[model samples]
Target chain A: MEQILRYRVQNDFSALSRFLEELRGLPGYARLNERQAYRLGLVLEEMISNIIKYGYDDSKVHEIEVVIRWGDMKITVELSDDGHPFDPMRHHCPGSNSAEPLEQRPIGGLGIHLARQMSEEMTYRRENGRNILQIQIGGGVAGD
Target chain B: MEIGFEMKDKMTIVHLQGRLDAETSPAAESQLLPRLSASGGNWLVDLKDLEFISSAGLRVFLMLAKRARECGTKLTLCSLRPGVRNVFEISGFCTIFAIEDSPAGI
Candidate 1:
């Protein structure tokens, strides 16, 4: 058996913690402690913020959808937004990772990079003109 | 997130408690920057009570730090929880900003 929790909220950042906090009461959540919860929260927040700030730049109406399902060994999270389409997985940092001057190096692209560092697997797709992001959390993965 | 500010001697410390995720980031940016700008002293961010912070929160900090540098003031971060510290370290912000493990040493 699996558990799923779904939520929809405005395209804002203040509602993110409250949205993610509702998942703490699930059965499998007992296996994932506060540190794991914090990682999930961080990644989800980064994705949501990017969607609202850059995807929906015109401040139009939009909805954010989050779904989490847990099994015996893995936790799956799906975050979808009905705003403009943004595939953060495709973004690449423009710097050479050199010790060059700060002004000459690029400043952006840290969000997706951090997500890649935290999650076991991350996937992005655009279906029906909506940005959909999927991430999986496994029990075997060590905490960063 | 609830934000409280305190001024001690020549430095202003901003205590950020709770989650500094995407939604609460803008409110923090709007509230914290103006105060930091108006004050004539350096800023030390106390994140001891902060349970979580995302890249959006990091973005706000970077922007505020950049603004502070441009205005000839210093911005420092102290007392980061383990979760928040990992985000900061993973994002390479520890190199970009001044960070300390404890407020007592700063």
Candidate 2:
């Protein structure tokens, strides 16, 4: 059996708050084990915040779509937005500079990296002025 | 997430309570950055109560670390929960911050 939860949100942080509530309350979210749930939440927040912050050139409002599909084997999340076509995966993960010590390491450059690191697989596509991202994670449905 | 600040023996101790992901990081950044700028003293971050963190939170600590280095100040992160520590280790942040097993040693 397959189960899904979908959300349509404005390009505002307030929308994110509501979306998070729904995600947490999703029927089977509790059975996903702690790590997978955390990943889903982290990816959702990171991607949507990027869209809300950089998705538009003007102050006008826009909408973003989030869909989560889960079953016994794996969980998949899809995010689509009507904003500019920016691929989160294109950015490189600059290696942390452990040699120079913590103080010298750069401040930025970890959001997309963590998103990539968390998901087992990810794909991105652009069409008709919309950007879509899909990610797959987890193994068997057994609780941890 | 709640953020508390205290001065302990020349170290500016920034104690984080609760998750430090995207949702809470903005609040954390707004509260912590100003203090970070004014602080050239050593830093001991107490993360015993923090259970989660994402890149957004990582960026905040990194900013402080980089700035402190530029200012020749000291920074240390201590008492991370296993889950939060994994986020840092996964992001390779474990190597980027001076980490200790407990806050008492710092």
Candidate 3:
């Protein structure tokens, strides 16, 4: 089975909520034991939030274009936004392991790291003044 | 996001439900951080019903843990669903925070 969702959502939390609900309502989403589906939601939410929070230079509301392809074996997410040009894949500090002491660790950056770690694969690009991120989760696997 | 504060015996248990993401984390931090500093540093957060947690949510928990250590109080997170637990595992947080099967098991 295959499903695709393409929609433009405002930079708001309600948009994130609405997108999640749509993902949950897919044809075979419920049959797959929501954990994998929830992983999709979490990855999408984190990536989009970063675009909305840091991608824009001004406070003006922008539309983030999201394309989700729900396939039989895996789920692919392609998120594009008209915010600033930044690559979530390359901008953050590299080689920061999760083994740092709690006191020495920074509170931030873990979100993007989690988004990177959970997905089976992820790619980022900057094209035509937009930031694009693609993420893949749940590759022929059920549950955690 | 909904947070309920419960006084269980001598420990303060913070009950969290719904999604703890970028949108709801600031409020969660404001409500959760102050209590950890009030001399009772021993804390238990019940995350059984917390369906989703983003990195923003991790920051709140991390902040609480860092502060609790300075104050010499313990923080135990219990009843985490597998999905939520996976977030902790990947982040290597299992080594930093005390996690148990249930609040009673803690």
Best by TM-score: 3
Worst 10 residues of 2 chain B by lDDT: B62-71
Candidate 3, residue A81: how far the Cα is off, in Å = 1.7
Q: Is candidate 2 or candidate 3 better by TM-score?
A: 3
Ranking by lDDT: 3, 2, 1
- Candidate 2 regions off by >4 Å? A25-27, A93-106, A139-144, B36-41
Model 3 chain A is weakest, by summed lDDT over 10 consecutive residues, at A91-100
The reply for model 3, stretches above 4 Å from the true place, is A21-32, A93-96, A142-144, B39-41
Every candidate's chain B TM-score:
0.95, 0.92, 0.94
The total of clashing pairs for model 3 equals: 0
Chain B global fold similarity (TM-score) for predicted model 1 against the true chain B: 0.95
Point to the candidate with the largest lDDT: 3
| Candidate 1 Cα errors over 4 Å, as ranges | A8-18, A21-31, A52-65, A80-86, A93-109, A125-132, A139-144
Q: Give the lDDT of residue B55 in candidate 3.
A: 83
Clashing pairs in 1: A13-B22, A13-B23, A14-B23, A14-B24
How displaced is residue A96 in candidate 2, in Å?
Answer: 6.5
Write candidate 1's Cα lDDT for A32-123 as tens digits.
66666666666676677677677776666778888877665566889898777777767774432434344554555566777767787889
